[model samples]
Target: MSELSRWEDLFREGNLKELSLGAMKVTREHFGNSVFLRGLLEYSNYCSCNCFYCGIRRDNGRVERYRLDDDMIYAAVDSGFIRGLRTFVLQGGEDPEFGTDRMCRVVREIKRRTGDAAAVTLSCGILSRESYAALKDAGADRYLLRFETADTELHSYLRDGVSLERRLKALEDLRSLGFQTGSGFMVGLPGEDDELILRNIRLARKLELDMIGIGPFIPHPATPLRDAPQVPLEKTLLATALLRLFCPRAHIPATTAAGSLEPDGREKMLSCGANVLMPNISPVEVKPHYLLYPGKICLDEDGLHCIGCLGGRVAAVGRKLSFDRADGLICKRRDRVEAGT
Candidate 1:
């Protein structure tokens, strides 16, 4: 069968290998062998909401928690820079302590340190428009706020007090401010329907986001959804393939959550249409401590395993990580000579 036909067969038959190979081919076509890597620095474990699938819900007192200090963040960023990571993602939960002013200061310092050597992407959960603007002003180039699910009633069921309208608005808000916006969804949440997946992609395309991140629902033991079954790998790949067909050229990451659930999930996702990766650069001391979902993979493993040692994984499937500068941000940096950017 042809490439497009093969992808359709995999989805219809739910075949992992066929789907993965086709998706990988698509990924290679767009990204070549180059795997764009981002340093995922989990700045804080504290959060305000109670997502039924997260281990770090505010009520989870049993979960060990810690927040990275400004000095610590600087140190981590320095380490990542040396490792040739030009994309740094400051990811954290929604803690009141990390207010707009505080986060802007953090973003400013990161930008100063980056010095054209990196892009700062923020995944610090939901925030007010003022907070979002403050961070954007501080040289933060991207914002990754996963919507979890697109269905309104189901969205509210999974995430308290959050709605589809609010999340979609946040995405629009980020785009209007000239930030590379990212929206995400789970493959299978309770009460989720395949139509929602189509709708989610439709909305993502409508937003013209720079990135769209997604992961299968992985239940965490201290939460209400602990007993929930894992989303099958087939479903995840199918969604990924459709994303490739839909988005064509948008950046789609093969998330660690995929790797956490299935040993070879990254390779599978790569085959399906993933082009970006977020390597965990958090201090190993606290890396194992931060658990949004328990049994998250590559946390305790050395960073080499997550990126470098994965050479075998990529090569096994006819793809390789690229070590060149990346392209694609909603707002292109205007030439200083022309627009005085």
Candidate 2:
């Protein structure tokens, strides 16, 4: 049988034990027992695009949108930094109010405050090449712009006519600008199949991404895909293991979406191959409003509390929670460039 057919059979039969073990072995070879932790700050819910599966899409009337000022953003970073988080992910929707200049200021100030102690990662969605270069110049070390899917038709449909080509272009821009680029896809989207999943994996490899985050698709009640069929979490876990085997050095996170699916879902992914965890450090009041899908965990918990919980989770699975900046291969390459090596 062909390699694709073999994987298809494994996925079809729901036999992931051997696959997961192999993935775990590869992860151990590369990352050892250290799982990097990134503090996720969802500072805004305002977005420009109206994606069908997103909870904070511009057309969604029910989400209470709010953007954090510099003071609030700084405070969140300070809190996480105190708790020993060296990597802070400033994530939000593509709000125009937080334009290039404002974002540059934010990145610069954060770097100033943290000195060389922290690395900042941005995930605010697609932007112009100039904007990306400006952010990189301002001290942003990593960028996550998930392409969502490899199938052009489903990608455009889910994103309301935004072509896969456009998304891929944005990723290329980030990479060319020397950002530690990260991208991912949801495991079970409407119209997604084994072929599409395989293609998604191939695309990640083709991009040579520094990070790969895969999560299961969960329906948001307020979005167009509210009534979409529920995808099994096992499929997502299988994909996670496969991603690990395929891209052993890429940083893969045990996404919150997995935890939302089951109480122990994130932990399960860790066993499979994931070596990173991003605990929500956004303010408690605004956490509920930043929901990309329903049943998101940790909306009520404070940053320190979430970190404490994740520490236990990591320990339970025999992995250490690393406080290092955990710069991936791409980020290291950027460092070498800046150092004139």
TM-score of each: 0.89, 0.95
Give stretches of model 1 more than 4 Å off. Answer: 1-26, 329-341
lDDT of 1 by residue, 1-341 (tens): 76545545555566665555555666666667766777889888899988777888888889788988989998988877877778888888888888888888988888788786688898877777887888888888889988777678888878876787887788778877778778878887766666677677666666666788988887888999988887786688788877766666678888888888889888778778888778888888788768877778876765634667776677776777764547563344322334675
In terms of lDDT, the poorest run of 10 residues in model 2 is: 3-12
Prediction 1 TM-score vs. true: 0.89
All candidates' lDDT scores? Answer: 0.77, 0.90
Provide the lowest-lDDT 10-residue window in model 1: 329-338
